[model samples]
Target: MPAGRLVLRRAAMLFAALALVAVGVADGTGSAVTTKPFLPDAKFDYQIGGGYPPASGVRVVSRDVKDVPAGLGYDICYVNGFQTQPDENGADGQPLEGTSTWFAADASRKQLLLPNPTPEYPTSTENQRYSTPYYVDPGWPDEIIVDLRTRANRTTLAAIVGKQIQACADKKFDAVEVDNLDSFTRAYATLADRTSAREGTEPEEGAPTLMSKNDALAFAALLIAKAHSLGLAIAQKNTAELEGEGKAAGFDLAVVEECGATTECADYAEVWGGNWVDIEYTASGFSKACTSVKSTISVVRRDQDVTKQGSTGYVYAEC
Candidate 1:
C-alpha cells in the first residue's frame, strides 16, 4: 500500500478499536451495571400523590419517593430532581423528609439553591433549613430550584439527590421518574415571569442566576447517570422538547404529564416509541389520547391531584 493509504488504514483501524470499547453504565461498585427497562406500552397508572392497589390490569405504577413500592407491578419512584420537593411543614430540629429535609433548608446551601428572583423576597432567612422563601419556584411556591449554573454546584446537588434516588433502588423500585426537569423553561423572577415561557426555550437568566433548558438537561443527565449506576431505569419526565437530548443522556423512558390534554402525546411517542407514559387530567384529553396515542404508548387519565382509589374526586382510566 502507498504511504498515504497505509496511514489512512491505520487511522481507520484505531477508530474501529475505540468504537469496540463497550459503552455502558459505570458502577461505582467496580462492576458494569445495566438498568432494567419497563415493558413498553404497558398499562400504566400515575400515583405520584399516593399509592393504592392498581385498578385491575395496571402493569406500571409511579408514586412519590416518600412512599414505599406498591409491590404489584413495575414500580417507579417519583423524584423532584431540579427543585426541592415540597415536603409540607417540618421544623429543622424535628427532622423533615425528602429535599426539604435534605440541603434546601440549609442556609449555607444557598449556593446550591437558586436565589429567589421574584420576591416579597427575604433579605433574611426563610428556610431555617428548606423553605422556598429563599429561592422558591414561583409556579410551585413551595418548591425551590437547585443551582446548576456551575459544575461544582451540579456535582454537589447530584451527590445529595443521588442518595434519595438510591433509596428508590433500595426499596426495590424498578425505575425512577424525575420531575421538574423543565425549571429551566420558566424564569421565576416574579409572579408575572412565571406565566411567560416559550416551550423548549430557557428563560433569560438575570442577576442572581436563573437556570436555562440546557442547564436543566445537564443536571438531568447527572441524575439519569446516577440512576443507571444503581441498576435502576430513569425517566425523562414531561419535557417533551428535550426528548432527543434526554435520550442521548441515556434516559430509559419518559413519564409525561398532560401530554394528552395538550394534544402533544405524539411528540413523545415519536421519540420513546412505547417506552413513554402519557398522563391526562381531562376526559376529552383521555379520549383523544386513547384514540391517537394509546396504540403507541401507555396512556391514562387521573384526577388532577392524582388521588388514590376511594378518595373523593379520584379518577382513573386506562387505554
Candidate 2:
C-alpha cells in the first residue's frame, strides 16, 4: 500500500476504536440510570384542584397529592414540593398531615421569626392574613413559602417531599409532578420589586428572603434522585427557566401552566421535545397555542380553578 494510504487507514482505524470506547462509556453510565417514562402524545387532563372522570380519549391525567389515580390512563401525582399548603383544619390551623411545616426561627432557634404585619389594602380578603411567619405570595396568599437556602432545611424538605414522590410510586402512578420549583424566584426582594413596579407603589420592606435559584436546583436534584430510586419518573412543573437545570437534575417530563398565554410554550417544548403537557386557562390562550408550534404539544384549556366536569365553572378544551 502507498505510504499516504497506509497513514490514512491507520487514522481511520484509530478513530473507530475511540468511537467504540466512547459508546461503551455512554452505555455504561446511561443504562445504570433509570430511564424516564415515555410521555405519549395524547390527550391529557390537568385536574389538580379536583379529580373527575377523565373525558373520553384522555390518555394522561394529573391530580393533587391527596387524590387517587384515575386508574384509566397514565397518571401524574402532583405534590407541592416548595411550599406548604394551607392549613387543612381551620380551627387548629396546622400544616397538612404528611407534609413539611414552614416554621421560621431566630438564630437562637428558640423564638419564631414572625412576619411583619401587612398593611390592610382595599383588595385584602378574609383569608389573607399578613401577620405570620409565612411570606404570603401576592396572588397566592394561601401557600406559605418554604426556606430552601440552608442545607438543614433542604434535607428536611427532601425527607418530607421525597415521601410524597414515593407515595406516588406506591399508588402506582405513572409519574410525579413536583410543583413550585420557582418559589425561590418569588422571594421577598423579587416579589417586592415586581409588586411595586406593577402597582406603582413603593417597594415593600421587611419581607423575608429565602432560597436562590441554585438552592432550588439543589433541592430539586434531591427529589429527582429519590423519585428515580423508587422507580418513579418525576416531572418539572412550570418554571420554564429551570427546565434545562431540571432536565440535568433528572426530571423526566414538563408540566407547564399558562405557558401558551405567556408565549412561552415553545420554551418547554424545546426542552422536553413534545414531552410536555401545557394547560392554558383562557379560550383565547388555548386557541393561540393550538395555532402555534405547540399545537402538537398536548395543549389544553381548563378553567382557572380546574373544577371537575359537571361542576359549575368546569371548563376544558384541547388542541
Candidate 3:
C-alpha cells in the first residue's frame, strides 16, 4: 500500500479499538445502576377516604392497590409499606404489627413510634391516651410499634409491598404511594427513648423487622427499583428528610401531606420538583400550597378525617 493509504488504514483501526473500549465502559456502567423516569407536575387526589370515584375534574386518585378503580383520572395506588393498617376492631383489634420495634434508647425494650404529629399535634404519650377520640383511626394512630429498621423488617415489608406492587401492575395504575416515610422523625422523641432502652438485647426472636436507617434506605431503593422495573412510579410519602436521599433511594415522585401548612413545600419542590402532590387538611393550607406550587405540583385539600364522599361531612378542594 502507498504510505498515505497505510497511514489511513492505521487511523481507522485505532478508531475501531477506541469505539470498542467505549462500549465496554458503557456496558459496565449500565449494569451498576438504573434510574426511573420522573413524572413531575402531575395532578392527584387522595381519596382513599372515600371508596367512591373522584369528584369531577380530579385527574388522579389514590386508593388501596387491592381495591378496583374508583373511576378517577390516573390511578395512584396506596400501600401502607412503612406501617400496618389497623384491623376493623380498633387499636386492640390488631396492630399493623411491623417487624421492628422502637429499640428503646437504652436497648432493653422494643417500642413503636407514633406517626409524626402535624403542626401543634403530638402523638399519644401513652396507650391509654391513644384510645381517645382524637387518636382514633382513619387519621392515624397516636403511636404504634414497628420493626422497620431491621433486615428482617425490610425483607418482610418488601415482600408485603411487592404484593402491593403486583397489585398496582395488575390494576394498571400509573404509580404507587408508600405512606409513613417520615415516621422516623415524627414521634422520635418518645420512641427514640424506647429504642435506646432495647439496644444490646438478646438476638431478637420471631419474623424479620425494621432495617437500620441504612437498611431502610437499601429497602427503599429495592422497592423503587422493583416498581420501576414494573413500569410503576414510586412516591416518597411525606418524608422531607428523605428528600436529600430520594434520588439515591430511587423514589420518582412525592405525596406530601400538609407541606404548605408546615412550610415544607419548598423542600418537596426542591426534591421532586413539580412532581409532588400536596394534600392539605385546612383551607389555609390549601391556599398556601396553591399560591406557591400550583404552577408546578398538584395541590388539594381534604377533611382532616379524610371522610368519604356523600357522607354527612366530606371536604375536597383543588388548587
Tens digit of lDDT per residue, candidate 1, span 198-242?
122334444122567678777777787788888898888787657
- Best prediction by lDDT: 1
Residue ranges of candidate 3 with Cα displaced over 4 Å = 1-42, 70-73, 89-139, 142-145, 187-215
Q: lDDT of candidate 3?
A: 0.55
Query: What's the distance in Å from true for residue 160, model 2?
Result: 1.0
Give the CA lDDT, 0 to 100, for residue 51 in model 1.
Answer: 84
Writing each residue's lDDT as its tens digit, candidate 2 over 149-169 gives 677778877887887887888
Relative to the true structure, candidate 3 has a C-alpha RMSD (angstroms) of: 15.1
lDDT of 3 by residue, 1-319 (tens): 0000000112334433532331111111244332223334445667765567676766677877657665544577787665555433325553333322212221322323222333234333333333221221222443343445556656655766677777787888767877655444322333333233223222222212233346456667767766766667777777665656775566666778887777777777765555567888878878988988787767888887677788777888887
Poorly placed runs, candidate 1 (over 4 Å): 1-31, 88-93, 97-104, 118-135, 188-192, 195-209
Backbone collision tally, model 1: 3
lDDT of each: 0.68, 0.63, 0.55
Off by over 4 Å in 2: 1-36, 90-95, 98-132, 190-210
TM-scores of all predicted structures: 0.79, 0.76, 0.66
Candidate 2: the clashing residue pairs are none
